[model samples]
Target: MDHAPRAPRRPAAPGSPPGGDERVRGAHPHAEPGAESDPDRAGGFPRPRRLPERQTVRDQVLGALRGALLSGELCPGAVYSAPALAERFGVSATPVREAMQLLAREGAVEAMPNKGFRVAERSSRDMAELAEVRALLEVPVVLRMARTLPAARWEQLRPLADATVAAAAQGDRAVYAESDRAFHRALLELSGNRQLVAVADELHRRAQWPVTEDHGCARPGAAPARGTSARLVTDATQHAALLEALAGGDLAAVESLVRGHVCGT
Candidate 1:
């Protein structure tokens, strides 16, 4: 769905207008019976308050926990204990449990048979599968965006790409992950379908294990031959090629390059 447009800003009434001092019936009631009162309303400004029907506390907790998992702050082989999370997030255990259950449904965390939720583990095979899935979904999106999106928006990606390169140069894995995520998001946004963009986002989130593994890109269980991303010049070259394809609007080459780059990486 298209985003709702923001309401037009009301013209400022000459300056700092206060509340509740409108000239009701053309008489200055606040002034002593007959004196000219300040036209600006005073005494009735609305106070800010929480809405009863806004997102539940559990939802907020769930979002925070998911963000933590995605950012690699909460490593695999760790437990997401409700009481502990509650203490961390300044909420009650009830909301924490609800949030953990939500994360479990999304496969970000797993409920242990005997206890709390554990950070879900992804093996080398899982990484390979995720890379394949990402390639399938993202490559075409970039191709399409390159073909149809405004040149202005396409140009906007250069800074994001530069940031990614800088992060890589400095070995700032965290910044690198974010800039990489932003660059792809901009590409996917050009698809002009919120639903499709959301689908790609979910895929990106799931593929994070393989793409930017915090515990180390390839561990004991991972292998280079399983179609998982390579960690050398191949990765850099593929990304450069992907960027070039986008720059050139090579729609036909988009899918294959994306697949090759991701799988190559």
Candidate 2:
């Protein structure tokens, strides 16, 4: 049978990395057809889209890595090489290495020389300890802020709290984690203590480590188990309740809600 001649390939644009666009578009071999066209459907370490001009490739990879962690795509205690992740993300290894290094510094992963980065594992006790510490630091500060922070300031935080609820409703764990942290960080920032904010942020990141089964096994690429979505929505709803309690000067309600929210009581 006769065949048509193949068209000549166009040269990459000046200053553009070779195969840059194609790599990003072609990375998702398993994605459903037309999934890339809709950002909402591009779950779990999605290909980088056009971001703000200021966002670097490393930043993009870091964000995706965090999302992967939250979604349990990068299971706890598993080692992953930067080059492998680079190919998965359709980016160069340099950005993935830099991003992994940043994650290592953030305590999310540990560098394994001549191997790869291992996702940090947390025991049940470790989670409890983190929760206790968070409660100790955040509950008191939030209570104080409730009394002194202006009503308008509390109102300003409404949008952030709502963002968490929105993310939860969408059943996107990664998005919920980011919005959840944003809500807490914004609330803490009202305390006007940069150091406290920094510490609390780190603790929050640690608290969000992907949970493992009782036998220390991780379910990779699994959907949230039964009741997980409901729990997320319930937890996210508390953000609004917290703001209301704080704004109403209900110290008792604020204490209860903040403790439950922080410690997962």
Task: Indicate which candidate wins on lDDT.
Answer: 2
What TM-score should be assigned to candidate 2?
Answer: 0.74
TM-score of each: 0.58, 0.74
Which ranges of candidate 2 are over 4 A from the true structure? 1-53, 214-227
Cα distance off (Å), candidate 1, residue 167: 4.3
lDDT of 2 at 234: 96
Off by over 4 Å in 1: 1-73, 89-91, 148-152, 166-175, 210-241, 250-256
Reference-based lDDT, residue 56, model 1: 90
- Give the per-residue Cα lDDT of candidate 1 at 242: 63
lDDT tens digits, residue span 227-263, model 2: 2678789999999998889889999999999888888
